[model samples]
Target: MKILFMLRDPFYEAYPTFIEAARELGEVETLYPDRGIEKAEIIKEIANTDILVVAKVKIDKEVIDAGARLKYIIKYGAGYDNIDIDYAYEKGIAVTNSPGQNAESVADNVFGLMLATSRNITKKDHEMKSNHWELSVGHEIYMKKIGIIGFGAIGKAVAKRAMGFSMEAIAYGHYLDPLAAKELNVRFVTLEELLTTSDYIIISTSLTEKNKGLINQNTIRLMKRSAYIINVSRGGLINEVDLMEALNQKQIKGAGLDVFSAEPPQNALPLLDNVVATPHIGGATYEALVRMADVTMTNIKRYLAGEELLYRVYPQEVRK
Candidate 1:
């Protein structure tokens, strides 16, 4: 069997176990596409691949068809929206992700974004660089109404951190864990209530068809003018154009985005002000990368040995 790695940067080192196991599985090839390549490029390079290891790359039907021998696909992180899971399933290809690998790092990064947005950290730093001594008064996150949209491991971590800051936390999800929510003191509320009542909205939901544009203009219109929204989840959860319009029209106080609809947009949008845009670095910490790689390799080895995987992504349990 052969394994192909379609990765973003060439700097990631494969886990030691994966390197050792690859010797028994023939050669391991890697494909690096241009940042702006079309679907044809992806399809072309996936030819003859068996197992495809991907990271933030789109694996549409055409690309799937190109990999005639593909038996499995492993995403580096938790989100597998980049892959066409339906097609992969129909073709008998198992799709997996390294969940819990980036949970702690993403939880910490979420708060970092929240604090930076609320305290105007980026803006103050820029002003001070220009020799301005005047202090810009920013809102304090303490005692603020924080609405978390999802209640997964990452969401629980974020809620706990918010409690430490004395923020009142609430959440909305398809299936609520009452015991977990009660333990964390997160109020279970309707999505509408979460939208209108929160002073700071932190989106921690996974991406699915139902949640693709959950944060559209209608939802944005419901938020308080003093509210700020943070998204460490998948980019499609919020409509980018609507978010930009809201920020530009002053409909919302501010936003902290770690993901975007089209990553590395053609040009900077006007929402740059009163908004902190990160290049999807929620799980980019060195510690997270190492841990995620180890988890990914473990899953691969288990699958090869015909054993059960620890961090598997079951098709039925997928967010979509």
Candidate 2:
């Protein structure tokens, strides 16, 4: 089998074991298209590939058509919105993603942003470094209410951590599993209720066409003026313009964003004192990378062995 691994990160260098394992299965060709490689070049590279592994690269219809021998497309992380799974399915290409592989790391980041934003950790640190002994009062998360927008693996993980802070966890999602919520002691609530009541509102859902700009001006208005917004999921989930306006007007207390509407955002949200932003690194921890690599390799091995694949996402009717 010939495998094409395309992503900006140097995965093989960071995890030599993964490349070694992949080599055992087939001939592996890794591509580092950091500055956006041309589509024609990508088409040329994928011409003979049997298995394709991707991170954030778009696997649209054109690229799918170029892969004459492609059998499976494995997303290195949880989100597969970048890939055109519908077209791939029509062409008999199976697509899968490593869901929950980085849930623990992302959950940790959610709290990191939460504590930093709520307690003014970064601001105070900056002041102290500049020889100013500023005493800015900050809010405590203890006994506070946290509203989770998506009750999936990452959302459940965040709820589990909320328990340590003695915070009330409530969730709003399309697919809220009652048993799972009960196990985590998370209450189910409507979106408006979650927004109005939560001290910290977190966006942890996947990005779909139906909910692309889920958090907009109208939704922001529903939130408490003192409430903070935290997002560790996809950037497209929130409308950046609306969020910036709300922050500027003090509609919300602050925002802790790991993802933005545009990566390396063109806007000034990152420069705002009220916004604590990171360059979408919620799932970039070493531990998360190891787990993601394992899941990717497992699925590849399963496909090669003609066995049942885990975390199959495409061909929705046959998803398992």
Candidate 3:
């Protein structure tokens, strides 16, 4: 059995263990490409692969069909939208993710973006270094309305930090559990209500068909003009063009985004002063990488051992 490890980077902590374990199962070849490989190249690369381990590279229907020897596909993180999960499952290929492995790391980054945008921290720092020392007025997180969209592990993590700052936090999730909400000390509110009321909105939801382009023109209009929007989730959640227009028009105060529709932004968002964008490094901490490495390789081992899988998210219908 051969395993082709298609990695976006080669920095996972348990890298040697991953290779050794795969060798114990069968032959293993790990490929780390700085640029995303094309579909034809991927098919050629994984021609003999029995298991495919990857990061955020796209594995569409063509790739899944071309994966003739693929028995399992393991993702490095929680989100698997980049994979054609349903079709792959239909082809009898197993898929798994390391859910919540990097939740706290992402939550920390979310709070960082929140504070940066709310207080103009990045702008002020730039101005100071450029020899302008004028102070920038910013709002406090204390006693303020903080809306958390997508109240999963990452969202709850942010809520915990918000509590430290004495912020009144509310949350909205498709999978809302009354007990969980109560435990987190967050009230459940409708998306509309959250939009209208929150002073700082942190988006931590996974991307789905229902919520794609969620924070669009109408939703932006619903938010307070002074409100700040922060997203640490997938870039598709917000309409980038709409967001830019809103920022340019001062529709809302500003936005702090760690993810964008096109990473490296195929556009001019970074050039905008009000928008603070990072290279999607919200969950790139070393600790998170280690946890993710452990979880992912463990799942690969599980597949070989015929044990029950961990953090399985695909084929929900079949699981039911």
Judging by lDDT against the true structure, name the best candidate: 2
Provide the global lDDT of candidate 2 against the true structure.
0.90
- Which digits, one per residue and each the tens of the lDDT, describe model 3 over residues 1-320? 77787765645333556567667777878776556566678888777788888887888888887878888888888888899888988898888888899999999998888888878899998899999989778887778899999989899888888888888999999877677677768999999999999999999999988789999999999999999999999999999899999999999999999998887689987778887788888888878878987887788778878998898767657766
C-alpha TM-scores of all predictions: 0.91, 0.95, 0.94
Total clashes, candidate 3?
0
lDDT of 2 by residue, 192-220 (tens): 99999999999999998889989999999
lDDT of 2 at 229: 95
| lDDT string, candidate 1, 95-185, tens digits | 8887767888898988888889888898888789999877777888889999999988788888889889898999999868888898989
Clashing pairs in 2: none
**Which regions in candidate 3 have their CA more than 4 angstroms from the true location?**
10-25
Question: Following a full C-alpha superposition, what root-mean-square deviation does model 1 have from the true structure?
Answer: 2.6
- After superposing candidate 2, which stretches have Cα over 4 Å from the reference? 315-320
Candidate ordering by lDDT (highest first):
2, 3, 1
- Which candidate has the highest TM-score of all? 2
Residue 87 displacement in candidate 2 (angstroms): 0.3
